[model samples]
Target: MRRAAFGLFGLLGIVGLLPQAHAAGPSDYSILIISRERLEVATSCEIGVYINDQLAGRLFQEQSTSFNLPPGELDVRLRYLPGQVPGCQPGIENQRSTRLQLAAGQINKYRIAVDQNGLTLIRAGLGY
Candidate 1:
């Protein structure tokens, strides 16, 4: 019947669109990975990750977290958060933010590091 034939054609058309729908999914966002897997930051306090002035993630020693965000420039700041641990009190360190340029479908990796200035982010290899 013509109706059956038309239904089969409609199903084929829908199937043809599946690959395009999936292809657009990953290209819409970028991956941002922040890690504390190094010994550069010798502290017991949880470090707060601020994105656009909002607390987005917390990292401890030997730990890492990631986010899939839309491609663009992001304002990222790292600072020590006040916790039950002694000497981990807030407002005693710098609160400067770092600017990151992320492109669509790209992956960025950074590890926490410390310098004479204070806590900072250092770019690292993405092999891990």
Candidate 2:
């Protein structure tokens, strides 16, 4: 009887740990950055995604322009296309910065407007 009770307790412990183990999968949050203007202003722009200042990934205009970052607070920055002439306007350059606090299993959407005035940044998240 004692051995049976111990085994039952062990089984219950294993079951309880299963959920936690599965939770270790990739973060459930996604980052979507879009330019508000229809024109391809950022012809060769590079977007640097950082989580708490640690470089997560760099995306170019031609490749996966959007990114999926781990669920957490992030300080994202968009660097101008190298060697490209800077726009005269304040927000015209590709360099834009924004901060976001993301929750687990959430989808975060950001709209960045780029034009003669530089870049305007906005963020919204769902599924906190």
Candidate 3:
């Protein structure tokens, strides 16, 4: 009877440890944070964030968004999206996609700003 009790306790202990063992697996994704809090972009239009050439999220002035993506090369594009405000129509401005290398368990930050050429994504510090 003592041997059976010991085996039962060992099985229970193993069951309790199962979840912890699974949680130790390597991380599979990275974090992407895009903010439009910069005043450099004076336009009030909503900006569309495209990931891998597909529209993923939209950002308005003073707004931000985040995504959990698999670690690898990502093609990010920003375009003006039409919104409630007038003059926020799409396809009027010329823009290009930016390629970013992301790693697992990493946090990448970017902010929308306007350069002499036009609207662009600027790499930003984690504090922002």
Most lDDT-accurate candidate: 1
**Which ranges in model 3 have alpha carbons more than 4 Å from their true place?**
1-26
As a whole number from 0 to 100, the lDDT of residue 70 in candidate 3 is 92
> Using TM-score as the measure, which candidate wins?
1
Off by over 4 Å in 1: 1-27
Error of 1 at 36 (Å): 0.3
lDDT, residue 17, candidate 1? 79
10 residues in a row with least lDDT, candidate 2: 81-90
Question: Candidate 1 vs. truth: CA RMSD?
Answer: 4.9
The lDDT for every candidate, in the order shown, is: 0.90, 0.54, 0.88
Clashes of 1: 0
How does model 3 fare in lDDT?
Answer: 0.88
Q: Candidate 1 or 2, higher TM-score?
A: 1
For model 1, how does the per-residue alpha-carbon lDDT over 82-127 read when each residue is reduced to its tens digit? 8889988876677688999999889999999998888888999999
TM-score of each: 0.77, 0.44, 0.75
Question: Over the stretch 1-128, how does candidate 2's per-residue lDDT look in tens digits?
Answer: 99999999999999887855445655476555543333344454554454455665555544434566566766666544343435422244454357777676555665554546555455534324
The digit string of per-residue lDDT tens for model 3 on 14-92 reads 9887865445667689999999987778888888999998999998879999999999999998888888999777755
